[model samples]
Target: MSDSSALTQKLQQQVLELPPESLPDLEKFIEFLRFKFQPRKPKATAKPALDATHAVRLGGLLQGYDFSPELLKEARREMWRKFYVEAE
Candidate 1:
């Protein structure tokens, strides 16, 4: 017999000699070996499409906001003051 087949037979004989109480642990180890050796499937690359519901919710959220440059500058300065000043 081939070396691999001989080794497999020897392992099988040893497993058969093991007590019944140890059989469950042996089964778990065999399962772990199978899982470890199995090839992994590739993950999907395509992103899920965004629906109209998200767009409507976002529009509602920003409906009353001013997006002017001056407003953004004031918001940034306020954030800097709140975090940086307090950190010191």
Candidate 2:
């Protein structure tokens, strides 16, 4: 027989030698192998349309607050100050 057939026969013999109680676990392993190696279908790339009714209103909460780039920069610097500390 060919090498592939010989290997297949050897695997079959080993599987046959396994106890009946271990069959369920062997079946689960075979299923896992099949699922792991199975070819997968490509997912749809199209996104669903957004509903205008559910759309968020920007700057609605902070309408009365004065927002500035400098304030944001200072807040970020203060928040991340601990991460930039140098070791003595």
Candidate 3:
């Protein structure tokens, strides 16, 4: 007989010799083994595409803000006015 069949016969003989009161515990252990060894299905991981209704509005918070280079330079100068070194 093949090793697998021999092992199966051995398990059958052992189970047959087990007391009736232990059968329920054996059934639960068999279920645990089946769950532990069963093949697992791959999980679906596709993300839903964002439509126009859920799209983010870029620069939405700065609709009326001025970003002119001259204004930016003046602001930077005002911020660092006290840090300027006087030339001797």
Candidate 4:
């Protein structure tokens, strides 16, 4: 008999002795094996702590701008990027 045929026969005998309910999840295992692996996410850099002085400066800067709802949110986001965004 061919090597592959003999191997298949041995594998079939092994499977026949296994409990029907306890078989490994072959599909899920194959899917796991087939998955394209990705690298782990990098840890974010530490943020600078906010202080009373910075708050006062921000308040002073924002007090003069036109503070419409959308503009307010955009300004807040810009301020965060300006003051808190990590330098790569």
Candidate 5:
């Protein structure tokens, strides 16, 4: 096996055999090691917020409805009509 892996396994065995009094410090060190090496999840981009006067959050608004692909198009067009149509 790899030298680093062999060393890690040896250290783990030593830690396992240590007295209970030594465990709290080892547990705290493990937490720090986990925080250092754990991969972070990617952050999701927030959806653009609706400026009801500018554009609606069509995806957010339509999330309440069933998966009607055709209706989604119609709802978007209706949203544009409401937001963009001149009162005159």
Candidate 6:
């Protein structure tokens, strides 16, 4: 017969010859194989649509407002002064 068919026959005989106490472990192994080969469902990804859209629009809105690095740093310090003071 074919090599695969012979191997299958040997495997079946081995399974049949296994002790009763080992059957539970064999059943668990079969279940593990079944679960491993089963098709998986795709997971849904969560996204913040409003925030993403707002960020995209904000980038476009600020595209023409080019400022110096020193000015931007000053603006950031002024905007976060209260938080910085509280941190200290």
Whole-model lDDT values for every prediction: 0.90, 0.88, 0.90, 0.75, 0.86, 0.87
lDDT of 3 by residue, 1-88 (tens): 9999999999999999999999999999999999999999866896677998889977679878899999999999976775564422
Q: Please tell me which predicted candidate would have the highest TM-score against the true structure.
A: 2
Per-residue C-alpha lDDT of model 6 across residues 26-73, encoded as one tens digit per residue: 999999999999998765875545764476444576576769899899
| Cα distance off (Å), candidate 6, residue 42 | 1.0
Write down the TM-score for model 4. 0.30
| Cα lDDT of model 2 by residue, 1-88, tens digit | 9999999999999999999999999999999999999999766986667799778878688687766999988888986786677532
Q: Over the full model, what C-alpha lDDT does candidate 5 score relative to the true structure?
A: 0.86
lDDT of 6: 0.87
Mark the 10 consecutive residues where model 5 has the least summed lDDT: 56-65
RMSD of each: 6.8, 5.7, 12.3, 17.1, 17.2, 9.0
Candidate 3 structure lDDT: 0.90
Name model 4 segments beyond 4 Å from true. 24-27, 30-88
Native-to-model Cα distance after best TM-score fit, residue 45 in candidate 5, in Å: 6.5
RMSD of candidate 1 to the true fold? 6.8
- Clash total of candidate 6: 0
Instruction: Sort by TM-score, best first.
Output: 2, 3, 1, 6, 5, 4
Per-prediction TM-score: 0.49, 0.51, 0.50, 0.30, 0.38, 0.46
Worst 10 residues of 6 by lDDT: 52-61
Stretches of model 5 off by over 4 angstroms after superposition? 44-88
Candidate 4 local distance difference test against the native = 0.75
